[model samples]
Target: MIKIALVHHINFNHLSLSFKQRTDYIEKYLEKILDAIIVKTNISICTEDLLLLKVWNPKVYRRLINHPKVNFLFSTHNHAIPLIYPETFTEQMLLGSKVILDLINPKKIQGVGYPSEVDFPPKISFESICKVWEGIILGESRIKISGLEKDEFSPVFTINDAWSKNKIRGHLSRRAFNYRDYLHKYFRDEANSGEMLLGIQDDYKKYAQGSVLLARIDLEVILFNAPIVDGIQQEPPINKFRDLQKYLINHNVDFLKVADLDKTDYKIPEYRISDIAPCSSENIKWNNKSLKRRVENIKFDRSNKLKYGIWLSLQCSDYYCTNFQDLCFSYGDKNKKTIFITKTRIYRDQESGIKLKLLQGKTLDQIKMNDNELEKYMQYFMKSNELLTNYL
Candidate 1:
């Protein structure tokens, strides 16, 4: 009875692809999912980059033009906005996406998704962003794979491990998936008990051009077949959606849209930045030392505003994102240069909306950089083990 949802992060390709091949990747890979949207039960396409599809496949783009069942929402630009950039940069990315989304169908689109689901800072979110943009915050699980203890999985929203959960089928054997046993050990204990947003994320084109993607998201399941991890075998993904759909025909795993929430007894929770575990700018490199880090908290002054001007080197994730051990809010001090950071509590801010400003530009870069303030804030993945493997 777990309420599940599937999300596809599209247009994100391998770093070394040629311009022409990039479009081909989508046509060859994403087109299969697009075709499924029409033949299978209805599937909603919420992306951070619609222009990726607009430029890559016009046929699929037209399908979403006015199709009510197949929806469109622009998430922020590809990067994890909140964790890496300043509040101003986050605002710019949101506005840029909003502008492009409006052009597609202003009336149809009214929500936005977070880039990597990074928790928003209290100072920025509670006071300004949500009230200004006035759009719904359409997002998923707040549980970072870097979760320290089994307890970390308790979030108002959820991350549905579709294939991992439906293992009785012919997908991965129970043995192979034990590496992912935390999915059950931590995430599933209360997955079915409440009204929460359930989601699954795509690893930057984990489903490639030649790969198989049976996007049965209407059943809240989107699947990508194997050939992942470079050296791994070419295993086939599960066709569990259809089977699950039939099972859910009379069950209680309700697939409710955001607008319909008010009719139910859903409660909105408030959060302070202190609610989240203190996150380090370090890449996740811990797990063996102990589970003690799971419950550690860092102190942050609500009154101390974020000090901008820190620049992460191009492709510098070494600076921020996952990892819970050695939690420190800022490095150095008033005497030395410091890097500011925050972690979001898993349950709060599930569907909160924010107001925003618009800037003019044909390309996203031009629009984002238009703000002199964002350039200074520049600089933040979804790899869980990458975080939990070493003592970070």
Candidate 2:
């Protein structure tokens, strides 16, 4: 079987807006994405959390929960963020996972990536992430084995209708064995079962606003490759995922949930990740290099007091408004920043009520969570425990 997986990277957008505004924005784009996925029959997708699903749209929630192919994977930001406080993060994920288990009804939740692909520091360390997820998780899809973010790093954005092999190494599949990152030797023995799990940072705002994407740029415009809106972008037509699903269907590609990675009966022909993970062009070198350098700088940047290498980029607007602005600015080179994406977001410490607790040198499990604290935290993140109240 030609096995392939698609990860719709779900994250709450317009975070800087009011609670209602955030919910509205998320709901609008979310339904658009869901419309694309749900329209086709038997199309399975792996996604971050269901907090938004449970909060905004009960009809979609019912359809998704009742849908046989839905798989809910944790972004592992504890399903929350904006701190070193395990209390905040843990409460969020613990609660989000609870809702997901009750709704999406996946057999297992083993994968963990960052929400919005932002790895904030002191708050989430690689060790901390592993520890936080170990007890709750079964496997991590791609844990720095390779950055699963190519749609953004690529200077151009495509609907990704087909899989083509390119010569780019590490960043994209250069050879026939082209899964971004996975400890596949431990799991699979087959060689070429298409691409492993392909992740698209699924956000309407990102595509609409031109941050995570910049489409239609000529190679000659290297100096003018505007990551922050200097290049042309392919605005997703309605039902954007249809062509992708149609292509896979026409090619006889079978969709696989991430949970399948843990079981036996691996099905690739020879490639470790996938024989068909498509690679971007040489144009990606400049943009991809900048991101890699940023990762390196963040690795040793002692300025944050927290460990570096937490997969951070000041290119995100969250940096500009957060306390980390100065640090990120210093860490980011003028020429080396990825797309500068920022939106007014409701940051954690900036809120009031239920004094937020900060976890200093603590494991995630050490903190005990209570309903009151979780409820308070949920209000800020999702507004009044909507995941719990609205879902049930």
Candidate 3:
């Protein structure tokens, strides 16, 4: 049976001013996309973008939340940043998972979608985060597995070196297999019942078409990239949707939701995690050396705690502003230093509202603001502006 699970990574960051001055453009596009999916094929779209949509337009959000075809997936609350860093663990687990669950509420969400293609962390870190999700956040909600694909990571164009490319590819493949094995082993008692589903993105037209085949696993789902309209132009081309619709119809492909995977008898091809070849020791040593050099280059100040918080709040802006205060409360004084360092890595050279290089060796005290002024800034930073408007 030719089966494909169509998925999209919903990122609120994409809806910034670049998309349009008004919000209706996004809402109209969302409705149109979902409507097309409903009419053209029997497929269910799996996405984590609904939460932000809920804030933006309640009517559209209701349509999706109540829709029989949409499958909600867990993701970090803020789409701009990676969920891999140690500082983001609490935000990913507590804030990210909770918001998704609370929105889904009585309806069970089936899978977890990584925020970005570049967001892959260590396999162990991924497992640790998923465990918390399985135990705490996913109450009565059964997720088969998380999805990752080469195309998602394709945006990282800096891996020009052959050795780096080989190492990354090997690492990703091993991680995919490892995740599959972990899911099966972790839920062995329910072996006959249900297994975690890992949806890897594979486009038939792409050179990496044989990824699923290479892994010796069946293609359970194939997701088409949805266009994120930027007011100026349409992405993925509007015609691509019609083409996909025709492709699915021509192939006589059976559409499936994440929940359906659990109910059916379909099983992921069994594979041992250890059997997957590891990256060479040379690659490992090079990576360590590179990381050490990067760490040594970034200078951090330990004295001013609030300055870091203010800087982070400003950098994160509306994306994660609300969580900053609580995050501060959660961490101890000593841990703030570590948090600041992690923040530097995550944000790096990303531009912020303040127009200053946030990661460049500037401490909280260096800003020339008094304690009371800093406290006032904290209060302002804690408040989040309207992220989405109800245009519908």
Cα TM-score per model:
0.44, 0.40, 0.44
Winner by TM-score between candidate 3 and candidate 2: 3
Residue-wise C-alpha lDDT for candidate 1, range 221-303, written one tens digit per residue: 12122222333322212222233333343444334332222232333232333333324432243121111121112233323
What's the candidate order when arranged by decreasing TM-score?
Answer: 3, 1, 2
State candidate 1's TM-score. 0.44
| Candidate 1 deviant stretches above 4 angstroms | 1-7, 14-25, 38-48, 65-67, 125-128, 132-224, 227-247, 250-252, 258-263, 272-278, 281-392
Question: Which candidate model has the greater lDDT, 2 or 3?
Answer: 3
Comparing 1 and 3 on TM-score, the stronger one: 3
Give candidate 2's total backbone clashes. Answer: 12
Q: Which candidate is the best by TM-score?
A: 3
TM-score of 2: 0.40
lDDT of 3 at 165: 23
- Identify the runs in model 2 with alpha carbons over 4 angstroms from their true place: 14-25, 38-53, 74-83, 86-93, 106-236, 263-383, 386-392
